[model samples]
Target: MSQSDADAIDEGVLADARAEASVAPVPKGSLWRDRNFLTMWSGQALSQFGAQITELAIPVLAVLLLDATEFEVGVLTAANVAAFLLIGLPAGAWIDRMRKRHVMIWADGVRALALATLPLLWWAGALQMWHVFAVALVMGIATVFFDVSYQSIIPSLVRPGQIAEANGKLQSTYELANIAGPGLGGWLIGVLTAPFAILATVGTYLASLVALMLTRDHEERRAPEDHAPILREIGEGLRFVFTERLLRRIVGYTATGNFFNTLATTLLPIFLLRDLGLSPASMGLIFSLGAIGGFVGAIATPHIVRRIGEARAIPISAIAMSVGAALLPVAALVPALAFPLLVAQSFTASFTVLLYNITQVTFRQRITPPRLLGRMNASVRFVVWGVMPLAALLSGALGTWFGVVPTLWIAAGGELLACLFVVLAPFWTMRELPDAHSASR
Candidate 1:
């Protein structure tokens, strides 16, 4: 077909997708009884657990086996998230043009293969820090595709009403993995060679790949259209996000929260380990205990949204997040209160943050056309997660120059300001999400 004909067909598909986004579908059956959704859920559960194991294992491997310096460790961390900045835009356009399930399965398989190579190299006594970095970078790239497709695929799995419930369950599994994965990683490393420990992670990805392959989703095929130039496609996604008032507000809310929340990741360890003189065991316990908040928040979100509406729930959650951020800095002031304070902050922060996550995810899914969903999600992630590496680097500079406590206070203050963005913006006052898909276009 000619380019004009293709564009016209795409525009028709876009119109249909927007209409679908505006209406709630009647429930066919509970997502629980839907075999396909269960299969998809099982895959996600496995993938999340595997990701957690690798997240811890990679850093531990570098520190223990490769004897990587602190600077190198920082670099490894940055490399893991660098793909969001580098590939986030184009990946979205690519995913939207392809089948989401295929993208997810291939991404998983590629990541598994990349990780499996580590053990072979290790067994040969030729493992190096650069190899680890390269693997991490590869994994990050695969993850970008997986994550974008993952969110975009959800509406296909369940009813619109069920999106919040489904998302809550997914978040619960994710948090459960985060709480348990590190401890599991530590055990595997202690019992087996660091290289061999990776086998479990590799196995999980394989399992996830298998599960996804087995699941049958009857996704409505989009019309065949001429592909736009990659950069223009990316710009289209960015323009959608920025032009829509609701999307613009959400983007601002998330970007601000992530940027200022950097101190929690960057400085919390130092404050707990050096300033407070806590054992690693105690610190781990604190985090694990606090992760319960995430589980609680996820479980509680559907109810919160139902009772108060998503608009109210989000601002309330933001307030909780701001308070959590503020408390981290103050925890150092009272040595006697330090441990308890950190634990409280951890729990409250996780719970509230997840509340924000579940609500926003459901809202976005409801308001965005399926065709633009991947691009919209990618645009949000690029702006939000893009700041993370820079924030990490900035956190180090500030912490070293101004001391940990002061830097944390600055982070906390920034978080409070972040809360205000959501509170004052359209997200807070809008009781219901209108058809933002059409509005954006």
Candidate 2:
């Protein structure tokens, strides 16, 4: 299609979306009554809970059960996120051609099947470190598609005005899962062992699949002949993100934050388990407690945006994130107070990150032309999440070379430095984002 033709299609899509929003029967601020949204939200709730179990179980299995070295654990962490770097750009183009709900359903199915193998292998007494890495890699690949579709589909399920609220609700559910899933998974791990704990994730993912299958959302699918070459489509996404000045700065801040955050996260389990001598249950409790901030942050995001203005909230949250990252090394320094300090770090990081995410994500979804939503999200993730595996591997090497505590100190410094991306930008002077009508074409 010609450039003018593509722009015309984009305008038509946005007009249709506005028309749909105007006629929506549900009252404003009432997503509860939107059955289609509720259906998708329910599926995500189950999926997030299942993911939390795997997040805890897999690392625990590698660390405690297989007695893997710190480098091995880092490699395992890298495997879990490497797909974003590998296929992140192409996945967006693919997702744009299919119904997002269908994409999400398939992703869920892939994850369920992949996780189910862990218990089967363990029961057969054939489970090994490579087996765990392979499963994690597959799950990560599925997750890349699922995550992109999940973000893109929300615009279809709710009115444009409700995007922030929708994202907040979804984020809140994720934090809720963060709070409850680890506690349950850790207890199950202590009892049934880490491999068996993975079975719970398998069950939840299947449940998520059923919920997704029941959801209905408005999606535009391109005919096979209408699709452009994958590389060209990916390039379109990259251009949109890089050329849009507001989005460019936000991506820079987020990509930097994620790099340092993953660096610390890659070794946190080992630090807690080996250095602090915490048991599985205790570690789970700390995670559960720390997630409380995220839960509260999700709930309070709209109010924060309203109070401080959306653009201003970004840098403010970035500043808070730096403070949160700083707490990690302090915990290491004063091991006597390590538990509370670590919990404090989790709380600060989760809360501020949620604040930053809801504000920026809502901005991205609102400003982008409807035709490019999938690619836009994908390009952003490709940059932000792509660095994660590299950071994970670096964390492993750093932890092994300098020890976990000192590595955490380095991670903390990096986190503080990341704030400069947003703090020094124009977002600090603005109060709100551009409306869709006035957004970049």
Task: Show model 1 residue runs off by greater than 4 Å.
Answer: 1-43, 63-70, 117-128, 153-172, 186-196, 213-233, 267-284, 302-313, 331-338, 362-371, 399-406, 423-441
Kindly provide the TM-score of model 1 when superposed on the true structure, using C-alpha atoms. 0.76
What is the RMSD of candidate 1?
7.2
Q: Which ten residues in a row have the lowest lDDT in candidate 1?
A: 1-10
What do the candidate models score in CA lDDT, each in turn? Answer: 0.72, 0.79
Model 2 regions more than 4 Å off: 1-19, 27-44, 99-102, 152-172, 211-221, 302-308, 433-441
**Which 10 successive residues of model 2 have the least lDDT summed?**
1-10
Encode model 2's per-residue lDDT on 239-301: one tens digit a residue: 999988778988887888788888988997798888888888878888888778876886899
**1-441 per-residue lDDT for model 1 (tens digits):** 000000101222233444554685535346778787788888888888788677656765675678665445556666777898888777767776788899999999999999998888988999988999899889999988887677667666666556655665675577678687656665676677567778778999999999999987667656666676778767777887788776677678778778778644665556665678765456556767777787787679888888888888777887778877777878888888988998898888778877887666656666766667656666777888887767766776776678778888898888888877778866556665566545454
Each prediction's RMSD over C-alphas, in Å, is: 7.2, 5.9
